[model samples]
Target: MPGTYPVPPGGGRGAGPATVPGDLLAELDRLLAPSVRSLRHSCAVDLTFGGSLAPGSRDAITIRHLDGHLGHTLRDLHVRAGYGLGGKVFSMGRPLVVRDYFNTAHIVHAYDRAVAPERIETVFAVPIRAGETVVGLLYLAQRDDVAIGDRIVARAVEHTRRIERDLAVGVEVRRRTAAYDEAATRDHRAVADARRDLDEAISLVGDPQARRRLREVSQRLHRITAGDDSAPQPAADGVLSARELDVLQLVATGAANGDIAAELGLRPNTVKAYLRSIARKLGATNRTHAVSLARESGLLP
Candidate 1:
């Protein structure tokens, strides 16, 4: 009996690094502590996870300040575009500071309700970018200071640099995960196509004996494509001959050159030739790519 495709057992897709960088947050607290050292002030960081604004808002100014306090809890109050401090920061990647809490022309008054309740005085906002992409903003506020100086702005930028590094790492991890997901999706589509071919073969063939054999082949192919059939199939790209396909299948299933040689009843040197030939036929630069393509094309399950 034909073996099933080796399905790497299903697990929920991993969301890369659920919690933000603890060390970075610690560093931020340490760095910002000096700025607000005299009177207790809070430092907050907020970001856009690409989708909609959580509750705090999407507009950068609102997201930076509002979410920092409430942690974006109120979906209804989410800042919209070009409305508040978050909006200004979103548009301008630089930092903005207001010494006196009550008066700032650089930003909108949309956050006045929340500010009035919080009794906020002075506010500073800075845009945090992952490279050129402005993902969110950072805000620091103090009720006493009417305006902050250059030193505080410099420290805030330094803090941003550290946080940006962490955010970049997170972005790279996400990119790799997305690439894997795309590859998996492509493999699934290929299997569906192969199954359709098998079904057509079984349906089109004539004679009871031939039809039974075809049906069996279809069932076996279905099992493999659906991840039930055991053993990986040979890699074929429509270019490889049947013998070449046989040679590659074993290679992909962790067979070494000599082991493939033994299985195919060919000399080790001959197996090497077959591998080279198969790679050329499949337009694969190396064995690994060849295997991946084979798997994706339903040449191997």
Candidate 2:
């Protein structure tokens, strides 16, 4: 029900062309071709990815790539939720098939103009979901009334799962990149603020002892604000191993121990050992303090 709605054509927020990359389209084309062959379908197959067209409107799935068929009607066609065969799949977030598209009373023939010209009688659609959200649909079709068997459906589902895994990974990579960028910006601001405060303190102080303490603090902050080349290197003493550094870097990115283990191909226990070693080397009482010391000591960037 959430992904089912129909509004005027090209009237939604994403009315323009979707920002799908060429490499992803190419990969989808490659995967679709093999899937059609493996399913032993004599007709054409294509992939349509769903994206938001406007706020509060259901996402429309558009034909991005096809392995077969010459009709321009099917190409670039936007399928809305609860409208046609693909729409039903999009709304339900699962696989659906109509042996006879025109004759089927189960789904509305909203896109008969496109389907009739293509002469596609049977259609099978599977939803490609990333996490809990359905992101796209994969379709296998035939020009004749052929019953889609269980084996073919199963194989198509498997391919959709593989595609979903790739999409999920891409999403995670983008999220982490954004997080790192925000963190870097915050670190720069913190360094500038520290320098400004130090300058103000030195100017305002009249006592000789207090002035010396301010200078010491200024020197410490300078070491942190300066580039790694000017700062004292931590690796020279071999205090923290390369593996421990790897764990700390991910930890600074807000990764849990389990995620660090998965990323570094280590056990959870091994990740804990690395963290303990890093904390001991930095003389930090906790993980947060350890990360602070690492950044200050030029062990992390």
Candidate 3:
């Protein structure tokens, strides 16, 4: 996790929050709201909201991903540890339920002003975790005091678990992509070194034939395998320029704009311009979608 999410300043998770992969957080922004919607639909709940421990947030669980929300009740609400229903879950690392949210003696009314707007009653809060790390949380609520029974609990857990699995996969992909890039960089350097040496050798040769033979070898050295030369790579569907392709490749690895700019020797603003163009040409709604579209279009490997 190159962009490690720091733990909530000395108060949230005692041992420090888990270093969530930036890819996982980005994926959550793309994936979690849909998961919450599905759960709400399947369970027939009145309201569903998904929350993630966003980067740079110290102790609030107010970073709702998207629209599973019923109203503006929870907007601008920062539920910290030991406060609201969500904060308690973040602190306790376990699911909690209240048959009547306002009347319950179990949790505080920190978000009461906010929660009051939805007129929500019984609420079920589950920690959206990957292994033991609590990356985020899922909430299921209704306007009435529905029984916080096995069925509701089971449904919420199952859906949240799927989200957890997705988070895990995103983290794994981030790890593998970084590893692959590191190896590829090393191989590139090796190829460059070999070609430099070959060029030096070719220059020293007296015979034109030997020099030509060495030059041919030097040209082929950059190819990963002999088979790569046999088939031409598919032309990018959008005909993305070389710089655009470079930006997208880094995007696929979940690199932030600053990192991508640094790698490509461009200004941050220039990187943003490239991304906007990439998104428009690809018809991609977001960064994650752009990478997916590029891969599907065979514009990326």
Candidate 4:
């Protein structure tokens, strides 16, 4: 509680206190070759999220690659625990190799469908890690009897390391940015509270002359709070009575009192009475000046 900072609504340590670093997911995807991208098109490599992972969840996953013009991405992932090739590598936190998945008696027989549809004769699954945690797994496979060499798996692991480093940097940037925004909001609120306290103290003075001076100061403060500027101005448009509007319109058009009375079917004295009321409401001088002031203040055309 000693160093607590007030955060604005929906703002915390993640809001870019500094400029956002580059997106790591896009960078990692770019490092992948076209062949890898095509193969991974079916894989569930979710790079669109940033946050802590759930207690028992890994960050990403891999699925088998299909051949021919199936022309569809992979869906319906079948996951197991240390069972099939992908599951074994995920649980052991080590790379797995199966030359012929159907013949692999050492690993569980689950995920047979994944291997069968892809015609996988040889496959490799390597777990991607952040520090000691296995964040995800990557799979490489060929449909025919060509052996998937160890070199390709090594290269994939190197890429994973690069992605992990970039991801850590981005996470740190987000955390620091959130902290700075929280501090700024705290400082602003403290300033606002201090101003409120000062206003309350100014209202509490008791001596007659002092009270009178304080009341004047309070009225000034109230004007500031209410956004009122003390200038000799017309009332806001539409604030005048119907008679006041008729008088103001005649004045705006430069009509004489006799002409206005004739136009409005009123006595000249009645017109004069409405004119005085309009002038008083608009804080204006006499007839000629009232018209000028009304036009200037936007109450009359």
Question: If scored against the real structure, what TM-score would every candidate get?
Answer: 0.44, 0.53, 0.66, 0.47
Report the lDDT of model 1 for residue 135. 46
lDDT of 1 by residue, 127-225 (tens): 555444444445566545434555665666666666667556755666688799899778878877887887676556555445434444544556555
Each prediction's whole-model lDDT (CA) = 0.52, 0.62, 0.70, 0.52
lDDT of 4 by residue, 162-204 (tens): 6567656655666688788788667656644654675476546
- TM-score leaderboard ranking: 3, 2, 4, 1
Per-residue lDDT of candidate 2, residues 112-146 (tens digit): 98878777777777766544454456777767676
On TM-score, who's better, 1 or 4? 4
Task: Residues 1-301, candidate 3: write the lDDT tens digits.
Answer: 0111112111234113556666666776677768877888888888888777666553556647434466776855667767878887777777776767787766777778888878888777777665666767778887886675677778778777778787778878888999998987887787778778876776677654454445446545634433254432222345678999999999999899999999999999999999888876665658897787566556687
Query: Candidate 3 — which pairs collide?
Result: none
Number of backbone-clashing residue pairs for each candidate, in the order shown: 18, 2, 0, 5
How far is 30's C-alpha from truth in model 4 (Å)?
12
Query: Which rank order by lDDT, best down to worst?
Result: 3, 2, 1, 4
Residue pairs with clashing backbones, model 4: 12-178, 13-178, 13-179, 14-178, 17-177
